[model samples]
Structures are given as structure tokens and as C-alpha cells.
Target: MQVQVKLFAFFREGRFIKEDKELPTDTTAGQVIDDLNIDREEVGVLMLNSRHCKFDTVLQEGDIYAIFPVIGGG
Candidate 1:
């Protein structure tokens, strides 16, 4: 399956860039994230089809998933 993976904030500065990930049919959102070796706290949100979902959410092929970093305000 072809899933689009995105990285934001400092993650983008690390070992991440625009790329496509391949996984089994039952792959969860969390698995893909972990494969990137990204720090969990660094991610603020996970959106699939514009709706926010948890990492356990099962990823569907051809879905436009966006992972953004946590934004903090003083």
C-alpha cells in the first residue's frame, strides 16, 4: 500500500522529507510514525482526510495524511 507521509516542525529538519511509505494492508497510523524514528512528543496532531485522528487509526491507501509538530504558546 502506498501511504503519504509528512513531517513538520523540527522533524522536517531531521531525517525527514517528502516521501511515500509502504506498509501492509492493516497498518496503523502509529506504526508508520514510529518507522520514521520521530519523537512522539514532537508531533502535535495527526490528520487523515482533514479529520484529526489518533495514532492507532488504521491508514487507508491514497489518503493524504499530515503530521504536524506541537505548537506552544507562552
Candidate 2:
């Protein structure tokens, strides 16, 4: 199955801003992060199809997934 992945903020460093990725069925958001060598602790948000989701959220074919890194400000 294919899914659209969008990386935000520092998450796009050395990576792509957005791209269509070929993934296995039932792949979890966490799995994709792991595959990209992203640290779970650094992940600030996960969105599936524009809705807030978790790392364990299962990704479906043609789904749009977005990842954001923790942002700090005062």
C-alpha cells in the first residue's frame, strides 16, 4: 500500500518535506518513525488524514500521515 508522508519542522532535516511512501498493510505510525531513524521522544504530534493520532495508529492505503517534532518557546 502507498501512503503520503509529511514531515514538519526539524523533522525534515536531512529528509523530505513530503513524499508518497510504499508501506506494508497495517503499518503503525511508530514503525514509520522508527524506519526513518526518528526518536519517538522527539515526536510532538502525529496526524492521520488531518486528525490527531497516536504512534500506534494503523496506517491505511492512500492515507496522509504527518509528523511534527517537539517545539519549544516561551
Candidate 3:
């Protein structure tokens, strides 16, 4: 299956802002994060097809997944 992935904030540094990735069936959001070498602690939000989703959420073909990093400010 092929899915679109979007990275936000620092997550995009030294990495692509967005890309289409080919994954195996039954792949999870957490698996994508792992493939990107992103720490689970750094992930603030996970969205699938514009809806909030959990790290364990199973991804589907042609799904759009966006990952936002934890933000810190005063």
C-alpha cells in the first residue's frame, strides 16, 4: 500500500516535508514513525486522512498521514 506522509516543525529538519511512501499491509502509524527515525516522545500529534489517530492506528492504502512534533514555548 502507498500512503502520503507529512512532517511538521522540527520533524522536517534534515528530512522531507512530505512524501509518498510504500508500506506493507497492516502497517501502523508507529511503524511509519519508526521508519522515519522519529522518537515516539517527539511526536505530538498523529492524523490520518485529516482525523486524529493513535500511534497504533492501522494505516490504509492511499491514506494521508501527518505527524506533528511536540512544541514548546513560554
Between 1 and 2, whose lDDT is larger? 2
Pairs of residues at least 3 apart in sequence or in different chains that clash in candidate 3? none
Per-prediction TM-score, please?
A: 0.83, 0.94, 0.93
lDDT of each: 0.81, 0.95, 0.95
Give the runs in model 1 whose Cα sits over 4 Å from its true position: 72-74
lDDT of 3 at 53: 99
User: 57 in model 1: Cα distance from truth in Å?
Assistant: 0.2
Which lDDT tens digits does candidate 3 get at residues 1-74?
99999999999999999999999999999999998999999899899999999999999999999999977679
Model 2 gets an lDDT of 0.95
Model 3 residue runs over 4 Å out of place are 72-74
Q: Pick the candidate with the highest TM-score.
A: 2
RMSD (CA, Å), candidate 2 to true, equals 1.4
In model 3, where is the ten-residue run with the lowest total lDDT?
Answer: 64-73
Candidate ordering by TM-score (highest first)? 2, 3, 1
Model 2 segments more than 4 A misplaced: 72-74
- Candidate 1, after superposition: displacement of residue 40 in Å? 1.5
